[model samples]
Target chain A: MKKIIYLLILCLTTSIFYSCSKDEPDTANSIFDTSAPELNSFDQWLRDNYVIPYNIQVKYKLEDIETDYAYNVIPADLEKSKRMAFLLKYLWIEAYKEVAGDGIHFVRANAPRVMHYLGSAEYDDRGKRLGVAEGGMKITITEVNDLIPSQIIYQEFFNTIHHEFGHILCQTIDIPIDFRTITPADYAPSTWFNRSDEEAAELGFVSPYASSLPEEDFVEVLARYITYTPAEWQAKLTQAGTTGSELITIKLGRVKTYMKNAWKVDLDQLKAVVQRRAYEIQFIDLDNLGF
Target chain B: MKKNSILTIILSLALAISCTPNIDPIFEKSASERMTESVENVKKLLTAQTNGWLVEYYPEKTQKYGGFNLLFKFDGENVVVRSELEPLRTDSSIYALKGDMSTSLNFTTYNISLHRFSDPSLNIGGGIGLAYEGDYEFVIVSALETEFILRGKKTKNTIRMTPFPTTIDWEEFCQQILDSKPEYRPLYLHVNGNDSLWVSNDETSLTMSYKKDNVEVNKKIAYMFTPQGLKLYEDFEYAGKTYSEFILQSNNNLISAGSTFVPRVPPATWLPRAAFAGTYTLIHYTNIGGTGTPYTKTVTLTEYDNKFLLSGLMPSLNLDVVLDYHFGKGILLARQQGLRYIGGNSLNLTSVTNEFGLSPGAFYIGQQVSWDGVSDPIELTWTDYGQYGSPIIGFVLWFTNSAGLSVGQYTTGPVDQRLWTHIKMTKQ
Candidate 1:
């Protein structure tokens, strides 16, 4: 009688377990989609060049989730996006490749994971925003649609890329201690915008924004040195006059040495490569990117 | 005993099953499935109307640019949009239904008409950081076969859309609204069988004025035209009637939409001379010649010879002048002025006519002050007030309220050779 009672209790428990554990509905497809997006020719080019090589995602399509909700920004123009992509690859990526010698390794390691392109400048209450780099992972480039393949505009944009990249490089390996001490007394982070570039240069800084802090001063020197021609740089230094020019020269020397010792990269050689690529852009037919 | 125990177990199991109550689902599908279905339903409704839809979009939450009309055609993943923005062109762009907290319609590609409102460089709505503070992503609120309501994701502005009839010519319809802009003049609001409201446009905005307890109550709002009519940013309500839109009718009359109780009547051909009699302060002055900054001065217009004559001491020039004008024709008659440099040296000069070689027969005033209630009635004409008619150009005058001026501050000149000046004055 005891054996029969135990058997009946076991049967009831097993039946309850079976009823409760009926197979959950297959929600894999409903919850998350695994299909890849349909890519146009431009997207395919980005995938082949930037994505496959450096693992960088070029977001030309304006995704609200990826943007600063505070801003009212529009998507990059398809034509402009294509041109800018090619230009960036040639001027920024390719130039860095030549500079580092190990073309793929340098970018694959230090390059930002994401690059966002905006058609218009992200203007704020204070002023117009050019570009921003966050956490060494994402770099947002604004005013992409305004590119006209001109030398001045090209240098303006390339300077921003180099400036942001310089920050990324510093994040990987801290900025040299010597570079910070060069202009330790002149750093005015809050009121930097009020000062003109000439005034900043006179105060031993490369640009007005450089006077904001030691890190900014360091990157400004690196970016301005690479983008400016030898004559343009000399003119800037000459305009700095006397003690201001001497201080800028000392800061720049420290930057050059730091790049060489720390990253094994020659600053002058990188500038030459970047300048050569920039000149090559004028000849490329932007309308037809014969991919 | 074993059989009895088994029977008890069975009875207990049946009792437990009967004790528990079953609950039914309110919705037939899962939440995710319902969300997907709602997205599809919205998309279907949008694409159902083959002729496309017309949208009245208010980009700014503050309603700075008022409302703009957009004609949109959705087919597959593409959308063709048209508006009255610069270049007046149509563009085909990509669009998608993206799911966030709710399903949203996003213009994935750059459309000139849609993107201009978001371009900060354009500064359409005049705020910094965000141009016009508009939104490209709109959450689907509700939709019917013929109409839909969408709320801007960022701006929180409500956009109303209705299907465009195939018979309506979109371009012509938009052009007609643009063509209906009234000539710069005073507008009157006829309400309660009385022309009690004074309306004016200050080039950038529309202002309606009425006396409330002996104090001038002015309500100024920016406005834009739609296919149906002119829409004011703020609704004008009086006597239990609210008006935000007006349908254009014959004879430059605007009938309030949905009601005939309030209508905007055009200004009379001529205004009474008493309308110009007031003490005004020089609030703004500009010299196009890039010289001679305007100093603050008070000018009083007194009714003279059945017309209005401006009498005042020019503070900058130290000259006493009296000028007469025709209120109806907006003409400034030639006037002679007594000139004397005050302070250091006193050189009393004689009065002269054709003082600036201004064509003798009342140089048809380029810009004249009118009581049309279209703008500040104190805005005087752009006249040549040079010394000895030697083209030592004088400033143009704009006036506002003298006692506790509420408008903006005074401005100087980046003067041009043509001597274009703008001045603001206030009535005391």
Candidate 2:
């Protein structure tokens, strides 16, 4: 009886050991450590720090994880994955404060989201062929790879959240007709092509990249207005050349006026906040995680 | 001993159980907790990979392209691109060869304009609209009304009234207006070699040395702004095509907004209406020399939003009148009104100086000056020897702002010489 009992105990131990052993691959270990915990400590951190502040939460099934290039990227390791989540959450909080201001943070509890392990795949180049979003369910990121990078993870988060929220704004209201008149007939993609910095400045764009496309142009203005100092933009405009400077100045003026006249938000204050946040992040000891 | 063994077993079992809780193979989180319902959001992502901004797809399942660089800002309502500079690059294949490549970009001029159309032939494209901020060089090619056949759709593009790209001779015209001095004021005319007012090629004649001649002219002169608000010399042109010259002059005015008055005498001097009003006038002659019946007509002026539209035409006789007028902001008029008879059936307002002979056509005088206020003119004295055969001409002048709206007049030396002379008049 004693021998039989010993055999049974050994069998159980062996089985348990085998099961636990499968979880310890060195390759996978390098992928994620802190992010692999049951509740994903990084996500918990986000919930505790970011989601509540912005009044938003994300939920998703593990298998339906979506990734996009702008706000997500392929991760290099578990540590990197954790860093990315932190960055995204941080950016979310920053964008929220910059755009929505105080007392405007709250989201329904049941929004859907697809939690992704930071080191999974490139949001645009790999993994699932869809985008990441929160509808009304809790999400889990089981895998970790390249689908989320730190820079992409942050910038894209800021952009996507803002853009999606912008859609919400539009769905609920309409913009003025005059805003559409500023784009002239000759605005071309080539306008951005091969233009020198001096020339681009004359044209009233922050950079050639801002001049690359109209959507970018608009978003850059929005980002600059909601997050940066108006003086910074104005200075940039003043430094721009003849062809595009006037247009940019006019556009910026219109944006400020629109924010005031339409949304009734104190955009200048928002601009101050943006500048402050940018300064804070720029000076933060991010350990070389520069965007 | 039994109790102690049992306690040890229980403790070990508890540890084992606690340590072996199955950690499901995947770390999963529910999707609903990550959304924010309290605040409006604008997801303005600058494309990281540069495939262009993702617009919506109709099917909701498939990815589609829309040519609009959506600026997801609080434009009081939704996120949208306000300018063509923010145009979304759509699928280029839908339009033409450039369309496909264009769709890959985030912003392009074509995406904002012609790319909106699915058809190639129907892209009339947006022209220089109200927001136009830069200089444009437009060369009038041709005018026609036609229906453009779009891809299974047709569009019509038409241009009704437009001006061909022609340079306005501003300098010479201004100088001539400056040369038309008011009844008693001395005037000086500055003729630049590069002056657009006159077609003269020699720069030497524009210098102070060209002013040595002393001469007189047939009519007194002054300066004013035009009825259409341009600075010009109000004078008549009678020598060139008889009635043809009059028709050409009228056609030119109508084409260029009916704002220019070409001088008849020197032929080089042109004046805007206001300058003509403040500066020069034609001495009306009722058959002073011969038996060609005297022509007369009563002219009436009506105001059209600060502009005077001359009405009533006498069909039979070519009549001339000496006139004076007042002009305020937005007002325009000329100083002199007169006529010269063309030999046959037409009479034109011209500057033909013949003391006893009947002029072929009736000539009219107009002066154009400044409406945006005038700049102090430099006091300059010079003589032109060329005017002696013609007559001694004197000038006085004033500039209206830096855009160089100058008002002045010119005259022949003492009216003793039969020279086609002018003087420059300065703004008072």
Candidate 3:
């Protein structure tokens, strides 16, 4: 009877322990919110690739779609999200081409979900941030209620990607300290708006929009590199009352040097790739929108 | 008991492993890194290229305009240039070049010409019976040594030169010539010369001369395949006074003739090529400036290809000026019309006898192009200015070709009675 009692107790305890162990929530499914069917694709991709394959632990509730992807605030509207994703992909391609030679690493959704509009350094609520090893990155474009029309959705998405991804590169490997030094002391929040065009010109910048901050300036320069041909920049300088000849030479020289010395990347080959990517996904059909 | 203990241990290990959460390190991009990224982004957004022109004019109607021609044989190069007048014509062809010269090379030849219609018969029923006998060659070469003229009572020396070089050291040259007269402001060689060498005596008499060997080739002038007439003076001192003689001939003729001669008096404005800064308001009646009160007029400036357009006003005579620029040749083609200046139709101001009050003219360095040999009526647009100090109160003109297009704008000058017009050009 004593042995039977002891055996029974042991069995009970073991069964209980096993049951408890089984209850350890499947982290892969923990982040999924069935109610938000719109993120099904995103969630699935993250699960199979991001979460399971890469074993990345991400803190994001699929149910709270409003605050997610601040850069894209269409409330997980499938069409809008798709569009934003497309534009982001375009910008990513564009930005990637200058730093990385060719081809981008596309991650599965579960690998590590990117949360939009969360970081303090982010420009908007949807500003972007990245996870290097496991989870990917988060980029925010706008507030939940501030969803833009499809007409400008692509541009806005591109801008957010451009801005947020800027942070990724900065964080991945430190940019040269000298780059910050040339940015000037007045470089701060909202400088792009505060300074006049002429003021910007005095500092070797193209427009005040490029004068926002050191970070923003970097992105703006990159955006221009992706969008404008050297000849085009030269033409713009002509409108500014000077040939962009010298400035162009200086700019190209600095860009090449920065990419190689600081980022250990080849810029020329990147330019070619970025140009190809941009050609694939630029905001061109806006003219048709009016029709 | 051992089996139970082992099972418990296995269960505990499983629970511990399953519950453990792995967090990924947040990656942050540095500013320099961001710059690299941004640069990467910029490389992605792209578009195309645009172009235009800028021109400056001198006091004596001499003009020099430098700009990039978007669609030309000389694409992507700054074509700085100047044009002058030949003795026997209205304006000479444009002397275009590739680069800017720091020092004046030497103004020996105004080898620029254009074919224009000077038909007096088209208006007054018939007079000089002037017809553009095909293309005529016109050049603004140096004033012949014998081409000196006695303008006033004083022995003021004056010579004829085409559109002169912009920079000239008159004082230094004057000191070398005459120790008596203190050199005033260095007069610009606004017409034809690599460097204008001018010397004057008592009055306003001026003599401009250049050597035959010091001529720099004008690229713009060469582009046009037209006959250009050239006349130069060969002046030598027979006695105490200077006597100069000149020969009127085409550029082809000069090359063909190759002879020299002496003269008795200085040559004034005798030109197969006109002086770049000649003082001549030849045809004048109730001058536009004569109207004491200012009036208003509207003008339309059109391009040759009918693509470029600009408009302005004229305040005094209430006339309109239609201005156009030949992008290929860098010429300012203008047409003037009075408020009541009309004839058969089409801005009839082109007729002088009808008092049409129109001066249809083309500004060039003296060269011509073969274009169906009849009087090629250059089309122009005009406007009038009624208000005082109105900006751009004149005309704008345009010209287009397979290469590209250009525009010229004219403004009313302060000299009202003088019918002064300032011109501006830009590429399109």
Candidate 4:
């Protein structure tokens, strides 16, 4: 009877300790300010064109944190940024959207989250970094100062976009496993620059950089095929000769099959749209962001 | 054992009761609140000024590239900037005062006029991997109504922004400062009477060099031009005095804010004025009317400031041959020097030697008819009297331009006298 009474007292002592504290949650506003800023007309245009449909942010106003700290570079020119943005949409974005049929959804799903514009090219000890992409999320395009309304002038930019977009698609859905086996011995991971473009093409590679890795090779082939005209593509095959051309044709067929099966994109139809828009850029008013 | 256990239980109860912990915060606001307030206050101070702010911007960690002037005119989120490096260039961009590591004033947009310093363009500044290494984001160290102290985010160089004076036009002000750069080399920087620095500058690099311990010590100060003078990047401490500003004197010397530091040319005369001032005997040989006449006289040489005045060069007229003892060469009478100005024209000295023509030097002007210095310290090659009609080869009197010299301006003699003039002064 006394032991039972002591146990009851012990329970009472623990119950007394719980009475002072309340279980109420905090009502104070958050320390972080998440309020949407009043956007300028250009920013509003960016929102309507890019963010609304694709959820991408095109930042011409350079934040030092957004750029590579190691590489010394400057912010993109405003006029140049407008020109490049309009050109990118006209050539790269619209091309994929029109032909892929479902690629409009594919791009909306896999497009870069952020695109940074730089006025000067980011140069290192070896040479210039034309464009840099990180983890299929962000893409920083340099040489905005060199931007012009011409097919030849903005070729590197278009190639870089297609190349990086190809990477994004491949990252989301892996490239064919057999694509690696086709040119297993031709890969030069470190000394790719030693081979000339013609030499690399003879080894069933599109460009010298494509010989760096199997993954790079797949993207380079996809990028070049989309950017190059039929005449240009044939000219490359001519340089490759019969044995080289046979190997390249087999590789390109696999790549085309992979794009059709994995991402549902047609390479030939995409090129036609891209070329049509690439030609249309000569007439577009670059400085106008009114649309 | 029961008694010890009872005492321990009592002690535990007492300890628990005594430990009433205070959970209340000491300050009224949270850390975030304080940070937000600080950022707001800084923004207010930045845009408070009516005119603008003058920035003393130093690029690179070591400040090897020196400093430049960047003027900022802020209106809300917009900021317009101008640079001394490219005087005419003005670029407008957006800025933000953020609650980052500190309240950092970030130049968010591309300011070609200003951000070129930080750009690796391969054209401006250093090329490729090398750049001016300037900073666009400035961490606010302190903020006040009149001044805001900032530290570069990357370079960590201290940058000061003060209210831009509304007195002068920006272009003319910068032009005046650039024009005030040391026109000659080996300028003297006087710290005081005893301690001094022999200063030389490469204006292209904007670097000033001095010799210390027989080794060259270079200092590059980022400067801003005010109406009166230039302000240094920071207070320069040399020989127990701190100099932050320099005022341009009327004599083209820059005097430090403390009045102790002055960078100027110490008088070019090698010897003192007293050393060159004394009476002398004048010897002259005049060949006029085809007859040579030896004329000797007792002349007086007296000190006129740092120059010397001789009374017997042309004895017939009341003329004092003012000789400037300068250029580290004894008594350098440049061809620009004139004498006896009558109306607008003056009778100037035309001394010539074949080996060394009238290139400005401290060669002796003598009365000798020969090349030997033993006869007279000064000598000239006298041409034939026949050549006087064409070029006038010998020393002859002609009314030259009083203002200065031009190539063929000294064509005809206004005064028609073909007088051969020479002077010899023997210091006694």
RMSD of each: 12.6, 31.9, 32.8, 20.4
lDDT of 2 at A258: 62
What is candidate 1's lDDT per residue for B296-363, written digit by digit as tens? 66777665322344555344443333344443344333332212212111122212122332322121
lDDT of 2 by residue, B100-133 (tens): 2111111111122222221111101111010111
TM-score of chain A of each: 0.92, 0.53, 0.54, 0.86
In Å, residue B110's CA in model 1 sits off its true spot by: 2.6
| Candidate 2 lDDT score relative to the true structure | 0.32
Higher-TM-score candidate of 1 and 2: 1
Residue pairs clashing in model 4 are: B67-B222
Which scores higher on DockQ, 2 or 4? 4
lDDT of 3 by residue, B43-153 (tens): 221101111111111111111111110110111211122222222222211111111111111111111121111111111111112212111111212222222111110
**Model 2, residue A251: displacement in angstroms?**
1.1
| Per-residue accuracy of model 4 over A1-291 as CA lDDT, tens digit each | 456545655665565465446535445755666578868767888888899988999988878778777777777776777778877887887777887758679778878999999877775644457787788899888878777667542358778878888888888889898899998998988767656668888888888788899999999899898888888899989988888888788888888998888878887777788878777777776656564
User: How high is the lDDT of residue A206 in model 4?
Assistant: 85
TM-score (chain B only), all candidates: 0.54, 0.18, 0.18, 0.53
Docking class of 1: acceptable
Determine the C-alpha RMSD for candidate 4 after optimal superposition of all C-alphas: 20.4
Candidate 3 residue-wise lDDT, A110-132, digit = tens = 11245442111112221222211
> Candidate 1: TM of chain A?
0.92
- Candidate 3 regions exceeding 4 Å error are A1-76, A90-136, A143-156, A183-192, A229-232, A239-252, A262-264, A281-291, B1-428
